[model samples]
Target: MIPMRMPWRQGDVLDLASIGSRVDSLTDLSTIDGGPGARLTAVRTQAQAFRREFIETGTPDSVTTCDLVTLPYPTRFGLFRASRAIAPFLAITNRLLVIRWHESDGTPRVLLFEPSDVELGRYTPYFDKLAGRTPDVVSKRMVTEHATVLTHLARLRIDPSEVDYLMFDHLHTQDLRRWIGTTAPQPDLGEQPTPVFPRAKVIVQRDELAAMADLHPLQRPWYQPGTYRDVPPEAFLPIDGSVVLGPGVAVVKTPGHVFGNQSLVLNTATGVWVSSENVIAAECLTPEHSRMPGLARWAREWGQEVVLNANTIETTVDQYNSIVLEKTLADRSQRDSRFLQFFPSSELTASWTNPGTSPTFTHGAIAHH
Candidate 1:
């Protein structure tokens, strides 16, 4: 077990009340169906019951749930490394890669890269807010705090030469700006002039580069209609096609969702497994505006479509892609259209007069009887 500090009062307990309060539609419950959701619910209820049973009956699991605390930093770092190691190959371009290393002799090292200036500003403030300190301080502290973990990796039982990179997914990177959106001095951050690994040339897909360029007010070439938005133009480079990075690893362009967003499909005799970071998340299963296909277009943003290889390896498989064109067209048709909405109280009542049940008021985050 790893010793770590809890950031919140509830420790490892997820705030169900907070999650429930955020639900605005039935679609919210769609993702909560059987399997993990059910399992999660059971765990929560069992924990509550155990508390009551132990407090009243003086009996409980030998190990209490609260007592089995999670190791925060190590877990986070592990996941971060995994995302970075897998992303470029997986075709994921949105996540940031932070590296920390320690020499076997005990010297500490920390490396940080923002890929670009916009990503840097977004993540810097996020690290600051989350750590309750300035971004640089938080970064330094993360290294100091996880020095032991770094030491362990450095002195690997297996040769260091055999190991390559570490990678993982980071969803919160995009959400970092939510707290400071359109409020204060949110200036446009410039490119990251100094890279974390100055000696190593960062491998950025052409698509990612194009997408980055399009984010600038002056570079609008990538966002033209018929061309996928959010993908960088370089993603279309011929070299991007099934290029071998290592003996076993290869980079394949699987764009969908955003123009440059990709997934890494690992090929081993066992099977081919794809790691698509942001193709979908738990929240996507919900029936929210975000899930609606055409919803983002009005804001000049476009949804990414995953590219699956077929017999030709250049086009989508016929059997699988039959519906792709139709769905894409439907989504395009709804572009710039308003979402479904309810009317004012009097109008709603008049429209619902024939209904048997009493009318319920619907507001963004509030529903009244």
Candidate 2:
């Protein structure tokens, strides 16, 4: 049906302007408003402009389908930190930003927000599973990013304290349960799991998450670099995505191999930049065949994965880093997290994608941390 669903394989090439025209859905933009009172206005005037640019550059023919789903802002979740984590700096910032996204009429809808510290780090049974783990502090790059968000919020005079949860609009139910020790109904499996966060909002669209799953480009042998491993039902959510943990930031679903696998998208003055979390290379969360309990099995089901980010978007990784590394920010050092110098071709690169080479659905992803 969808060209035999494959990971980042070479496909059609298109631009953003065409993509905008091809996709019927557009961002509501009202979500960006501070709250209900200000009369329905565009969420962020700045974001609206960025959206225009993003659509203008995307390629339509290369578009792949994503089964990714989306929810509202302020989705809450817990974040685990590892000292030797690949993106340790991003982990810290996760505490403040909630990355959420949604899909509407074949387009990806995204949003960013903040959550209260208590709501974000709520302890779950899974915490006991992470006995050997500890929290990750903010990296220099993260601090720089935080500073930028703060500057924007300050200029708007929005009190950060008002935020109770940095919710993500998207996440995998399996991963959600594992992270928070909550149970969800597996009607598909005729299994009833304990349901936690009865109040937590979840998006139930199927095709988008499925499309997102196809991005895992290369699968290696059980021991190779870009391969995938079978994950346990306990490890990931039925859906494929992650919630954002911080303010003005969100996590988008980038299914490579690992369940609960995610990519980070930061919204700054410069523009929106989605990170390639589990795409290409052995360093990704999902390595070649290395399945464990409590993870997403779809990762192994699909072959290797790749994230393609090959368009000349306004924001540059260098500029993004500079924004995060502002003097006022004292988070992690530049050495802490590796920042991209240039946006590589999706066809050539394993872990980066844009509208040109890959298919993406927009949605509201939560922010947390």
For model 2, the superposed segments whose C-alpha errors exceed 4 Å read: 1-93, 98-110, 113-122, 131-253, 257-272, 275-338, 341-369
**Full-model lDDT for every candidate:** 0.24, 0.25
- Which parts of model 1 have CA positions greater than 4 angstroms off? 1-199, 216-239, 280-369
Please state the error at residue 53 of candidate 2 in Å: 6.4
Per model, how many backbone clashes are there? 29, 117
Best by lDDT: 2
47: Cα error in model 2, Å = 20
Give the number of the best model, judged by TM-score. 1
RMSD of each: 23.4, 19.1
Candidate 1 C-alpha lDDT tens digits along 13-129? 323231112112111112455754363343334333322322221211110000001111211121211121211111111222223333334443322222222323234333335
Q: For residues 240-282, what per-residue lDDT tens digits would candidate 2 score against the true structure?
A: 2233323323333322223223334443433344433122111
Give candidate 2's whole-model lDDT.
0.25
